[model samples]
Target chain A: MRVALADDGALFRDGLVMLLEAAGHEVVGCTADGDTLVELLATEPADVAVLDIRMPPEPDGGLSTAERLRADHPELGLLFLSHYAETHYLIRVLNIGTQAIGYRLKEKVGSVEVLSDTLTRIRDGEIVIEPVLAQRLVDRPSSNRRDMLATLSDRELDVLRLMSEGRSNAGIASLLFVAAKSIEKHISSIFMKLGLPSDAAEQHRRVLAVLTFLRSVQDSG
Target chain B: MTLDTYDATGSARRRADEHWSRRRDLERQLHDGPALRIAALTLRLGLLAQKARHDVGGLPHDIEELQYQLHLIQQELRAVADRIYPPLLHEAGLGPALRELASSASVRVDAGGGRFDPAVEGVVYFVIVGVLAALPPATRTVDVVIRRDADGLALDLGDVDTGQIGAVRDRVRWVDGVAEVGDGLIGTIRVRIPCE
Candidate 1:
């Protein structure tokens, strides 16, 4: 598979090139910024374009690249790597009118084999979502959304509902007279069932989950 | 004077004063504390990761992964720093800062260029950010151009709704700037504040 890579961070970009090359994929194009990525994709023959969601010069370099790539090369596979599970960015990604795209967390690229597999899968016309963003889709208002949230038990729902109110885990624990560890467990379960990631970007993940929970209720209201 | 008149004037003054104090506190905390600490930590990690990668016979997978994770951590911290106080607004100036804000949102912001007071630049930087932020992501395009007015610096924010300018109006007013937000297909938020 031929892949093009774009990221402003030279270290990360070099690591990505090594990963792709080690996996036996051709790194036909390399660029440090977004506009160049779009340009490279246009001229270089590549099955997939992997982009960092944020880059320099443009506040949303990755996003602008996505827009240009989708518009200019509709058939080209796009795989966006982001630092956070930013739902707003996700929404914009989806709105670009292509289903065969991949949005994955940057840190999760640690699994090079999985990364290569995802790129191939995306090239084959599947929309690959990072677990966190997948959960957000499940939390949106719909029958499927309700069924997904129903996977959480009554206690879990109570925890999530309180979380949607912007209470910290410790605060919620105090309110419910439960141990902080137990609240953490429940929140973990909430994330697990909703498809959010379990990692160091805890604040971003928590906000994404709560935003989904809030949207579900707001829509029902 | 009536008690109601006294209360209204007093309350207005109090609210503005409180906002100024809160902004100062937030700015001081960000500038003097967390932002520097985060930048230092990021630098330390980068150095460590670089050493770890070379200190080993070859590029160790664990150290490489550590490098990747540190990069993410560093980016998030910088984002937090920008949210608290935009670094570009200070280091580069308003035009670059506004451009950063526009590019981040994937919206086009064409800002007029001129060096101004730091406070004026900060106010304009955030007001444009606030206005763009309040608009639905559905809003695809916005134009911001500055002008040298006879009285003050003039900012014309085109492609905005009157409602979208509420946040901008409040911030502009804080610096004793005049704001005119109106409704149209090209709803505009025009502001002019004297340089302090």
Candidate 2:
């Protein structure tokens, strides 16, 4: 997949480039600022845009950029990367009704295989979210929420709850006392049972789901 | 024809009044626009020149970090240079250069130093000449001592007017160095340059 990776941190940007390229994915463009990222997207089309939620010029919300891109170019697959696992951001992305949109925590970017798989899934029309963020929604103790969890297995629910808190697979493994390999299997099952799209870009759906769940919780509170 | 001649005077008076009003407008513009611009430009240029002197004048000390003592010496040098042989000191080397400064001021200077780098010699020379120029017209004499030790070069500037000691000390502190004011109102500025 041709990917456009945008992040303000110089070290992280370079690392992502190396990781993506090593995974046999061609990175079309990389930028340190939101304005430059928008410009790059116009000139260079990519299969998916992997963007940081907070970029230069303003360190806070990247919702404006995301909103602009969704309005102008609906076909462009968008993935928002963030350090924080706030659920409101996920709701905003999903509300756009874009099938390939994704949200992934930055910490989960350690392995190239997982990152490439996620990117590929998003390009294939999947709505991906990180596993830990998904677990937060499943774990929320509410009659209305329990109905949502009824379709997902107990293991999938567990993963979703952890995913909500922005924990990576390694983090979930340690918490569950299960092997990291088992965590991956459980995450796949969660996606399968949730009727979530399993496009290669599904990693973003995990983040989006958790973000949406968090927003719902905040709104209710 | 007689009526027309009478009206000519009235017409001439109105024309004159219009001319005077136009002249006043031009004068106001000159006062508020170009003249103010020129003044602002002059102040900016003056600050630039002062900053340039502060930077370029200390080139010879070659010390990594300029101490307060060295800065004071440079400030005094600028004040003195502004008064006498200003451009020459910047253009020429220090030995005969400072002599020119002292001679112009009618001050007696006894200066001797072994072969030193041009920069070190320039700073020492400027400080000596500067302190002499700073002295009040009533004060008759000033002394300058320059020495090279194992640690670095030390310049002892003595006999600066007591009243200016505070000003001199403040200037020295600006450069991250020290100054000592003695009981005799002797303003001693000691600048030590580490041997490179």
TM-score winner: 1
Q: Candidate 2's residue-wise lDDT over B49-113, tens digit each? A: 33344477654233212322333443444344334323333323343344444323433333444
Which of the numbered candidates is closest to the native, going by highest lDDT?
1
**Candidate 2 runs further than 4 Å off:** A57-61, A141-219, B1-196
Per-model clash counts, in order, read: 4, 37
Which portions of model 1 show Cα errors greater than 4 Å? A136-221, B1-196
lDDT string for model 1 (A52-79, tens) is 8757546667877788888888888999
Report the lDDT tens digits of candidate 1 across residue range B65-165. 56466556645765676676565554446665664454335344445546776556667777887877777875446767887667778988878767866
**Lowest summed lDDT over 10 consecutive residues: which window, candidate 1 chain A?**
A212-221
DockQ of each: 0.06, 0.01
Tell me the lDDT of model 1 at B15: 70
For model 1 the local lDDT of residue A165 reads 37
* CAPRI tier for the interface of model 1: incorrect
Candidate 2, residue B24: the lDDT equals: 36
Looking at model 1, the pairs that clash are A59-B103, A59-B104, A60-B103, A60-B104
